[model samples]
Target chain A: MSELEIAGCSKYYKKNGEPMCALAETDLHVKNGRFVSIIGPSGCGKSTLFNIIAGLIRPSGGHVLLDGKDITQESGHVGYMLQKDLLLPWRSILDNVIIGLEIRGVSKKQARERALPMLKNYGLGGFEYDHPDALSGGMRQRAGLIRTLLYDKDVILLDEPFGALDAQTRMQMQNWLLDIWKDFKKTVLFVTHDIDEAIYLSDEIHVFTHRPGRIKATIEVDLPRPRSEKTLMNDRFLTLKKELLLMLREEQVSSN
Target chain B: MSDQLKDNEPFIEDPSVRTTKLRRRAFVGQVLVGVIILFLWEFLTRLGWLDSYYWSSPSTIVRTGWKAITQGTLLQDLAYTSGSTILGFVSGTAAGYILGLSFWWSELYSRIFEPYMIAFNAIPKLALAPVLVIMFGIGFDSKVVLAFLMTIIVAAIAACSGVQSVDRDLEKMLVSLGAKRRHVFMKVVVPTTIPWIVSILKINISLALAGTIVGEFISSRQGIGRMILYAGQVLNIDLVWVGVVALSLLSIVMYLGTVWLEHVLMKGRAPKS
Candidate 1:
């Protein structure tokens, strides 16, 4: 029911008064309740495609369909999270977490009632009334993830959501994300530059080439469920990582 | 540990307590300086080193102020100054804040008015006091208008900068949550800019008071400024000092009141760190 499709999407920019292609025509599909990741180099149009998919930018040519309905240039069909967690500084954690519901016209009391359990369950129980600055980096990210979930949309777009976290915290957050993803049964489209992170968290990873970016390969990660640090040591995990590294290396070397 | 403690025994004050002690000493030193200056001025006048006619002694000034307070309509004058200041401050700030934030609604409107706002900010508003007095008349309306003029541009500029510096990510997050334009302004734009607006409040109050006093000075029959102007014209030096002291005290009280207002607005809203 929550499938997302990006059909023939492309983006162009004018540089020095000359039209330049940033993202070539690309198509992407995420079936119901699947975890998909987009990985590419720094200058590639991954973010351009990401913004187009989020409907934050209008593509030069393409259509984004959600659940078989055309939603191109129409935002609010999915929840979006960025690298920096944008919790309002003045709002208490409880209030910040419930902002999605608040914006969607839910009564404050009812939003609070619904958010209370999630906050308590997600290691944020005692900090319900504290401001955003009171929380550590990882805790704030958790709060942001909860906010995204509570938006009540089945499709969630996480653009380097854990990119800013330290290594240890990033691993823990990935496990936490997987647990939540399983429990909620939501479709997630994750964008990141880290191959290890993409392999660990995603069911499928789409690799993009440099500049005028388009998908170069779509690899399905076939690993055991309830994965742990041991999974990273597995031969399959190592093999997939090598394959992704080689693909990305080609782009990086070519651009250089 | 014992050796370390002994090494540090020359200065055992805790950090926070040391700061408090230093602040108390600063306050005491300020009061001592004021008292010493006032005593010297009064003593020099009485000893004829300074002429009593030209340089009024503190005691004479106090006596003149007491006489004015009990017998003259000094309270009414105080009330008049206070009224115009308050009316101008509230009206100007509210109107300017709303106008500045409204710039978010349309790019065209913001672009057109931004240069005009900068131009207005560059002009010395007090120079327009006489003209404002002429248009609004030499009554309460004139004083109120001058005060309003003094505060409006500053508040508008502050609010405009606040709106401009609003985090794009916050706005994007809100939009993604299905928030309308007005909702983003109200929830994200306004709250994020509150600190900026409040940071200007202290400056605005002082400017508003200056505007009211200048209006009073120009052509008013009432207010402390009027009393001071009239006393100076008539060479009533002691009365002039009385008016000066009264105005100083009045402004200090109003400044404290503004501080309290800022506290109320920013309570629990400041960043925890």
Candidate 2:
């Protein structure tokens, strides 16, 4: 059974008196332990899809199943990372990471115990007592990631997690994410407009159309595992990049 | 990021030394300004250019202050005023926070009571002191009630706005983490509202003190306000100036103490600027 299943998912917003569909008749299935990337132009409802899967928003139509259980209405089971770091400035790095555990009724001692290993593993050791205001953008984002991971959820939703970073920092974070994913082995649904990132990090890329977003095509990346920036030079990588660009460009042309 | 504080930077190079320097500079400036003003005032009064009856010289006021302190009258009156201020502040803040949270949690309560609360606050609280004295009598009860009446409105308004100002994104974050309504309030809402509440408390301190003094002015046997009233009636200009100076000092000290406590409570969430 698939880890996540969505059937006939549709969302609409009313502007004035008309119905504006965000996701129309969208259907997709994510297998367990898969790194899936949803790529599209701006305003393509990719974030809407993330919000739906993360149970942050209720779908106007259809249902979602997680691990063979209906979890369309259930919240707190799936972890979501937003574009902004959203780290509470009043909390220390360690306290921020342990927020999820604290919400789940874990004692301070127990939560710290669980969080300490993650902090050390993530190279945030010794800075745990420092406030979020004291940290750099990259460090803050890392803390946000660990915060979601502390929830112990099987699936993680990332919405343009690196979109706010500069080019160099984005590249660095992409590799960092790949390294963390290798160790943690959690299913990741990453949303991004950067086609190179989607191709570099995801096992399968789902190309979405504009406005009323729909899956134009699903292209599997048969590239070798443990990918790096050097892998972008491979012929297959270039070919996949060309195909995704074409699909995105064609969708833009059609929409215009 | 951790290394941001390690360098020999100007303001942050030696945090302790820099903070002490800043404090000392401020103290020096204040003293210089005070001395210059007193010199000018003394010159004017000696030349008979200013009314000495209404505005006594700084030295005369200081002598009166020393006398009051020596006789323990100043301390007694200060204690009485401080007692009423503290009692009213605590009770008013508590009632305001509870009501504000309830308004946030329940729309029914907000709709039913918000208008009445606004109207109550709109009425000048000083005008109600006489009525309060009549109802609660010319004792501590009237003074405490008057102070509470003056302070609680500001607290409730600030807290309600603070609750409404909670970041919606953070609210969603909490909700997705399986935080129930109460947990959301206790953990997210309350903590987020604390800075706002503390700011309101700072403002309410002055209002509460004003209310206490007003109550004493209308009807009271003892208190700093009563002493000032008696001094003014008898044309004891120096004693009146002493009372004014003492009240100003007390207010300044209380305000600074509240701010210091705020810093301690919000150590982690230091403002960037």
Count of residue pairs whose backbone atoms collide, per candidate: 0, 0
The lDDT of each candidate is: 0.90, 0.86
lDDT of 2 by residue, B75-116 (tens): 889888888987887788778877776777887878898899
Candidate number of the best TM-score:
1
The CAPRI class of candidate 1 is: medium
lDDT of 1 by residue, B163-262 (tens): 9999988998888888888889889999877887888888888899999999999999899899989999998888888888888888899889888988
TM-score of 2: 0.91
Q: For model 1 chain A, give the 10-residue run with minimal summed lDDT.
A: A42-51
Candidate 1 segments exceeding 4 Å error = B1-27, B48-51, B271-273
DockQ for the candidates, in order: 0.65, 0.51
Which ten contiguous residues of candidate 1 chain B have the minimum total lDDT?
B1-10
Displacement of residue B178 (Cα, Å) in model 2 is: 2.2
| Model 1 Cα shift for residue A125 (angstroms) | 2.0
